[model samples]
Target: MTPLSPDILDAVAHGAHHDPHSVLGVHESSDGWVIRARRPLAAEVVAVLDDGTAVPLTHLRGGIWEATVESFPGRYTVRATYDGTEHVTDDGYRHSPSIGELDLHLIAEGRHEELWRVLGAHVREIDGSQGVAFTVWAPNARAVRIKGDFNGWDGSGSAMRSMGGSGVWELFVPGIGVGTRYKFEILTRGGQWIEKADPMARAAEVPPATASVVTDTAYEWSDDAWIEERSRTAPVDRPMSIYELHLGSWKQGLSYRDAADQIIDYVGAQGFTHVEFLPLAEHPFGGSWGYQVSGYYAPTSRFGSPDDLRYLIDRLHQAGIGVIMDWVPGHFPKDAFALARFDGEALYEHPDPRRGEHKDWGTLIFDYGRNEVRNFLVANALYWFEEFHVDGLRVDAVASMLYLDYSRNDGEWAPNQFGGRENLEAIRFLQEVNATSYKRYPGIAMIAEESTSFPGVTAPTSAAGLGFGFKWNMGWMNDSLQYIGRDPMYRSHHEGELSFSFVYAFSENFVLPISHDEVVHGKGSLFGRMPGDHWQKLANMRAFLAYMWGHPGKQLLFMGQEFGQMSEWSESRDLDWWMLDQPAHRQLHGFVAELNRVYKDHAPLWSRDHDGAAFSRLGAPAWNPNVLAFARRDHHGNTVAVICNFSGVPLGDFPLDLPESGTWTEVLNSDAEAFGGSGQGNLGAVTTDARGSATLTLPPLGVLWLHHRADA
Candidate 1:
């Protein structure tokens, strides 16, 4: 065997290989338990621990493959192949970094006073017929007791029994089950009542925010057919048009079931494959948009009951649509009765102000260093998959969790030992969560809505990556919005804007979304963003839509975009359907329908392997004109070319090149009369080309999609 590189050995020494067989230390994060390690020995990183088990890396960076391995907790040795020499770290080289041994020992010590113990509330199970077995890890706590509704909101009567040697404390309640709300009261060095939620709490029912809890019971799911159908397919890489929506405002006067029925019917007709719901877990306030979560296990009752939510997912699956739930694990609200004051003191929060408080959102950050907190989140991610049959999860606000100084200045925020903004505990927890979830279920997808320039947020766990299936392409969204919302003249000078997205397209899967968040707070709707006469505006909108659909990444259109709704979305109000009666708005609707048809019918558009045609301005950004064009190639060598004119005036006869000589048909034209255009172009017509090229008319603020038949 080739010897592992020195860098790999050093990385493994620092993190990859740990004693206690804990290859990756367990920690919690806003998203989940994440595992982090230096890039492993590619190809040397095997599925099994045996010598022959190996997988090769296409390329190795710095002799490491920084990856997030979900299954890293298992017994495994780090090995590497360097110049055909293999090296593995045996027990002799194993060194574990403990909280007390690090340079940041003071901070770690302060957190351990109570936060560390409460964070290890893992391994929850049925202790007896009527009792629930709860345990935690605060080895230093002078005393720990159970407190909640089950114990009359008091911790003394049903205090837990200390389990020595494991830094664990256990408590068995005679009448507790899944629904019984509970917290922990512990006496630590600070001598304060630190009331915190059970780290392993599966459900919570705190009122005035999110009310009542229930026991964890098995649902008689008929989703077996859906799971089987899903396993048989390789997840539709193409045809992945997603409708990003906020469930509470999806439809007016519609219940969760009503919204599901309407949405499923509409999307099926519109040819979308998935519905990505904005965080569904019960949060305290509606204005928080479900980000300030209070109940990790229960679906928000505001939308409907838990069972109703399940039914909605099941129905979506039945309609051949996948469901992606937005998950927030970054921060918790400071509601006194909930997780904040559980046991009264800072149990789940950091004792240090820098780690405990998030100044940006005015919330308390999680102490991810705890094992139980890690398990609570890990199980939560899995809970959605197993109970609701959710096909995917979209981790929200990841940037805030990954860095300690996410919104703080040098003096305002605290730094790690390396003087980096990265939260070591948060990073470790995220890696663990990603690794554990992916290991248990391979096909289920984990998505990241991270805003930072963090590399590899969607990389595989085995590669020392974030282990997410996809990351939101915020760059694409920002650039596209900037380019499309500009005047034709200004856009012409800024034509190279679209080229910026390709830099990171291949690094990880990306989703180009026009989410609900954009249209709120006086930003107006998509149609309202246009800066022209009604006709010019609709044409501009149509051009933008066609461009968005033709872009490289997966597509997500917020609700009301398809129907050309005029007003900004409000949870208390319904989408403005009355606008559809107007002829001008009807044109936008028809054009959207046509765009969806073209997107769904084209096989080239569906393939997402980064092997499609794309072009941009060659040089200096300012001098280049505004324009982006690309072709989607099919397996049969056929291609569909899409060209857009972001300008306001006609370009007369524009020149074009084709892959093959043929009679090109204008399958769909955004400039046609049927789509609120000024009767400027012929519809359903063909232009002949022999030199595999043609000169065609380019309408201002329009999109032209041309198809070439094999015989042509």
Candidate 2:
């Protein structure tokens, strides 16, 4: 037998070797071929070749065994006897590198758009043998070993080989398949060991248990028609009434599959075109609502497996409702087992605390300047669209990513090269991600939850803009909700608070969101926000919703608000669904359903939403009367007039100017008895005079949708 170096054998035995495959597998020496194996706590070790030759290996020291063979065994299995119990398994070190040169090149260059496919623990087949190939990037680590359930949580014999200059470590372990729980045991340069979950894991253990899962999905989708249609249609041109909800609290104790039918049926019945879920990425704290993501690629195992989420999305798409996931690329939590201080140094997060930390959120900001980090986030966006078949991504906390001094004091931030607060690297990353997402998926919407006046948020990246398909209209939400929360007796002086949204409504593609943000943190529910007794509260809510739908933008309402939920939102429990048992609540729910039906049936409400010519103010705001009116027109010249009365008393013979002199049908009346209203309205229909004027009876704290009859 050829003599082996004692230091080399010790390195392999201790799992500190950077290239374990070179010394552990079969190698040719000057005299003959030699085979080495490392099986800790084994009484005997043997190499059995495909030619039915079993050669006993001599134990040297520290579980290292060696033997000389006359010929090189092309394919072989290792037999190890522990306490006289012989176990046979394919040799992991015999196989070639699972990742290719091109992949390594792209990964090193930070241009690997499909980084998830290459970097995580993946169930793969090599040489007709089923196993998993694991890869991770940790340039500063002295060594990395694969430790999992298969190895008794030990990595002594599973040291991974480093790919030079790429900072990537890889290992292909045989005899392991899907559903295996694993984590990387990395040896830092300081001689300390740290365990981390894979950043690109497609599936992970349910939070409170941080381990990357070796997973392979075989989910068969039935949404080909939905996908094909989405590719051709633009979200901006379509009607998008998003129902935003937190899946965990939408109904407590329900898995993804269990909630699929319920969510699909409820959203479809409510006439919402899409359902926007709170961040579904794996997070340790359920209370974080998934904003602080640890596993960027893995669908939170809290909802079942990754495939379970795919099934839920598939069922929704098959039912004709699109899914939008809230994505958080702004920051990650500082969990020890996560990406914080990865590789015994600052890796995924920025090294500088001023730019790297979010003091308000107590999270670590991503190092957007790094190529690999940028690639990691950009690819995560694509993974959701490509893997989950999601229709859109509502990027969370975009304002935090755009400005370096966001939520920070002047002395706590470092400016860009041009001495500006703008984070140039993050801006570049956003533009790249948006442009790439659109180029790859034509109809997918990339919406930003940006609360600032960052110019051109929805403009094209080619035109030097951020290139988001839509931005949440935070200004509108704050102003409108503030206006509606006041007593009706004092609302006349606050006309601008409600009407101000129209001034910049068309500035960017906006979604007038009464989102979860408005109904949380002691801010009460939408029903609670209304300023009046029970009866008038419902009236104000109906009027507010009517005005929102009639406004020149898309709409997004948080869960529970549709039925006038009385309490603030809580992620710890299910929504107040029991409120539906009440008559007034049921009526309000019915009114919202009918309102969505009317909104969808009328093209004038959505078709030309962004065109200035399609919208016109109906006279000026009637401050004393506490009334607002607007006219919306479609390409076919069909007009729908929306009139809202915020006063406590009814107005008889209210003079309103029509876009045309003809019969106008009262399509929707919030004051109708069917919706718990006072049953006061303009008797179904009215005729306008030659001057395009009509005398109408407006309900107290109510709204009306008047559609012009084509035949008249």
Please list the residue runs of candidate 1 whose C-alpha ends up more than 4 Å from where it truly belongs after superposition: 1-157, 164-212, 232-236, 252-255, 612-627, 685-688, 709-712
Best by lDDT: 2
Q: List RMSD in Å for every model shown.
A: 18.7, 1.5
User: Could you tell me the lDDT of residue 76 within candidate 2?
Assistant: 86
Per-model TM-score on C-alpha atoms? 0.75, 0.98
Per model, how many backbone clashes are there?
Answer: 54, 0
Clashing pairs in 2: none
TM-score of decoy 1:
0.75
Residue-level lDDT of model 1, residues 196-247, one tens digit each, is: 5544444445335333443444556666777886655434355677888787
